[model samples]
Target chain A: MWELIRANKRNSIVLMVIMASVLLVLGFVIGMVFFGQEGGFFGLMIATTIWLVLTLISFSSGDQILLSASRAQPITHEVHPQLFNVVEEMKIAAGLPAMPKIYIINDPAPNAFATGRNPQNASVAVTAGLLARLNRDELQGVIAHEISHIVHRDILFVTLAGIMLGSIVLLSQVFLRGMFYSSMGGSRRRYSSGGKGGGQAQIVMLVIAIIAAILAPIMAQLLYFALSRRREYLADAGAARLTRYPEGLASALEKIAGDPSPQLATVNKVTAPMYIVNPFKKAKQIKLSNLTSTHPPISERIKILRNLSQGASFNEYSDAYANVTHKKTIVPVAALSTKEDVPLRQASAEAGSEERLDKQMRQVGDIIRRVNQFIFLTCACGLKLKIPPNYKSNKINCPRCNKSLDIPRK
Target chain B: MGTSILIVFLILVGIPLLLILFVIGIYNALVRLRNQVDNAWSQIDVQLKRRHDLIPNLVETAKGYMKHERGTFEAITQARSQAMGAKTVSEAAKAEGALGEALSKFMLVVENYPDLKANQNFLAVQEELTGTENKIAFARQSYNDQVLFFNNKIQMFPSNIIAGMFGFTKRDFFEIEVAAEREVPKVSFS
Candidate 1:
């Protein structure tokens, strides 16, 4: 998993650099056409400068922006001690440097999301319905899945994708405006004067520019969704690894899938893929098409998890996902039950080793107490007496008695 | 002059459009990643608080029957205090670990006094604690997922550029390093 994440990090850096250069080249091209070579160079520099500034602002205040947009309310330990404790537990488990602030949204939908630029500044928010619905193990599965995203650095990819998409839309608008403005020029100025080939070339370039403007955002969206889906699957596997229980997450997914609540009011297409489950609602009993969906089909995901319980490795899981693109079989609700509830005995046995360790510690504490109870003796002179186990070899002392005394080990 | 116009059109009009689109894309992506992180943490917080709230009730119920086990009671009380007073992730983890240790001890003491285990109030508290433990696990899972998303953004490429420029850094996953920390007594040797 670590290796995979490391590779992803490397890939993302290259992707970002490529994206920046692409944007810079585009800026330079625009500048040259409008104002000549020198103007083009200046335009490129300006665009880069603007991008740098925007990136800075986005990084610093992104979390706060998300929190407010989600309408999440900050909670104290007093207001929600259970949530605080769970966050504390995960922070230690994940080796985070600081506790992320906790928030709750009033929505009844059983959904949760994490926001922030990084670990220290991160925040997690969940709807109220999720709290009322999920059991302990299922909930852990969900939380672990989110943490896996954080650990793998999928957030960076998603953020960059969003930025790229936004830029594409803005540029398209500008292009449309320029096209409209250029069209208003007088037709009397001899179309033939520029020569046939040059006119053709001009037309072609304009076509290419318009097409690129239209296609870039679509391409970016596809890439963004692709990344989101892959990360979700990876997170599921990571969550299983973190909790050491595939069933927990599988069950949580089932619950989320079963819930029919509409997506949160604040969520839109761009933000939808980041959620644990797709927050949007489709027609009940309607199978999801893989081509259009932001998430992997839920039924397929459940199958992979069940396979994991039967000892399938993640590589197999991925392979299965890749190979099987058909509409998923709807496993009966009974089958869901079988996979959902982990038996108490199994849970205890899984926890048995630690329980034994705790027992041993308690026994040691008992022994220490018992030893303390019998180790001291009183002197007739009203001073405490101390003696070695081997009274003949070591002198016993009684301040008042001025006599050696014997003592025994408890 | 026509060729120049063509070249000029390509240079002047085509590129800025693309750059604007790219910026918008990056911004939206950042917003989404940030939201996921927030959601994940909230899940964890809710579960943790549930666990915390349950402790007092558990402690209170156990108090009456285990009257003779003052040391166990004190340990639990102290552990709760420490857990509650904990201010940082690591500190809370340590305090929670201590509290778990104390809680298991208290449960062990309750074992010798079957009456305490059988008490309606004690059973209710225990049931609630167990439920809270499950919730805590769920919340942790969700928090970790968001952490994964946020960290990935700060660590990954193009987003990392924005992430670094904006001082966005990788988030630490709230995790328990040792399984020993979560251990509760399974006194049912049977």
Candidate 2:
């Protein structure tokens, strides 16, 4: 595990440096094109400043912003004790120093993600649909995957690399838009005013700048997504190792990918990559060779997971990964070397309790209502009454018992 | 001649300093692994305590409906007490296994009482018990993993030399004594 983390840290640093250089070069070329040779340094400064500020913002409150943007509600242990328990179980299994904060997104998409700079500060958010759809083992499998992200510090790497990508994309967009507006205003006059040789050189620089602006964002995104995709595999391996049950995660992935719900309402480009599966793309149509996809194809992932027939160790995962993908192993050799054999455990007894669809839906409805500050009252006839906060009547009759119950005021 | 003296001095002092630093690194690593093993054991203890605490409530909830099954309740109670009184890792493992067997027996007998199965309080207790059982199993697995890593480190080459010098002892794994308990009691309410 330590070996895996060290390798992850090294890979993140190398990728960050590569992305940073791309950003700096793009800034310099664009600067030269616009403000002459001196503007190159100035553009570099602006790029660095932008990167730093964005990094700072994300470092401080990225998780909070993500939770709020997704309309995820902070849940107590009482709201869903099972979710909390699963998180705790994963926390112990992963040996995380502290339990991550749990949030429930109101969306019906069966997806989840983890955020925060490190394990101690991490938060895991799952949609209500995830809760309603998956059994305890599948839920454990998903939580374990997210916790692996936290343990491996993938969140920090994603945030930093994402900030770099954002700055590059932002700078290029501004330059391109500025060029469009200025070109319409006639760049011909300035070209005629400059000396012939200098003007020619400037024109050449402008062409290079245009090309860089167009290509830098694409390059950065490819690099970013490549790293992101690899981490997904690693996290999957980590999840399998921690849970010691590859089938749990395998079936969970299938369930998540097979869901036909509308795309998550809160999903945007910036937040889409952090999700367990790419929120923008459907699982069935995604090809393994797609370059810009943030996550690997779900079918491939599920295949790799299901192929782990030997055990749940990192070595087993890598072998299974290789056998299914017909590609080189993704897990670091160091990780595979030190791993002890991890035999899978039997499925938990609750795996058989597939609740009726309406019951599951009602349970999720109640959870959302609880999050919305609705008061819950149980009638004598065993009917659950959920009163909205805006409910006007002080005395309401139970529909079944016809008994008048006074509202309990805070 | 002066350069030769400098080289000799550098070799003598630099080599020892590097060796000391190397030893310190190994020693600190051992300490870290030791503490991890200790911490993992404590995690198991916490889950074990939670299991012990929940068992009485579980028995109490079932007792109201299982009036004729006093033997099952008594067996569970005795096993729980034995688990609570366990002193060492192996002792706890054995006691916990007996307790698990008792609980599984109680659950099997519960199949006869559909009313008890439907009781809300009983259902909740069942959930808590199942969660606790999972926690214990996971905790034990991790604790054993930690112990395996630590033991391997202290017994492996190069680091073993450092470990010997530093008095780092091997930690015992929290192994289940009974093979039956290794397969966790399937505490499914359904």
Which predicted model would earn the best TM-score? 2
Best by DockQ: 2
Tens digits of per-residue lDDT, candidate 2, A5-45, equal 99999999999999999999998998888887688999898
Off by over 4 Å in 1: A21-50, A180-199, A283-292, A310-410, B1-57, B64-190
Chain A TM-scores of each predicted structure, in the order given, are 0.69, 0.96
| lDDT, model 1, position A164 | 55
The runs of at least 3 residues in candidate 2 whose Cα sits more than 4 Å from the true structure, single-residue gaps closed, are A283-289, A351-357, A392-394, B183-190
Model 1, native contacts kept: 0.00
Model 2, residue pairs in steric clash: none
TM-score of chain B of 1: 0.78
Range of the 10 consecutive residues with the lowest summed lDDT in candidate 1 chain B: B177-186
lDDT of each: 0.63, 0.88
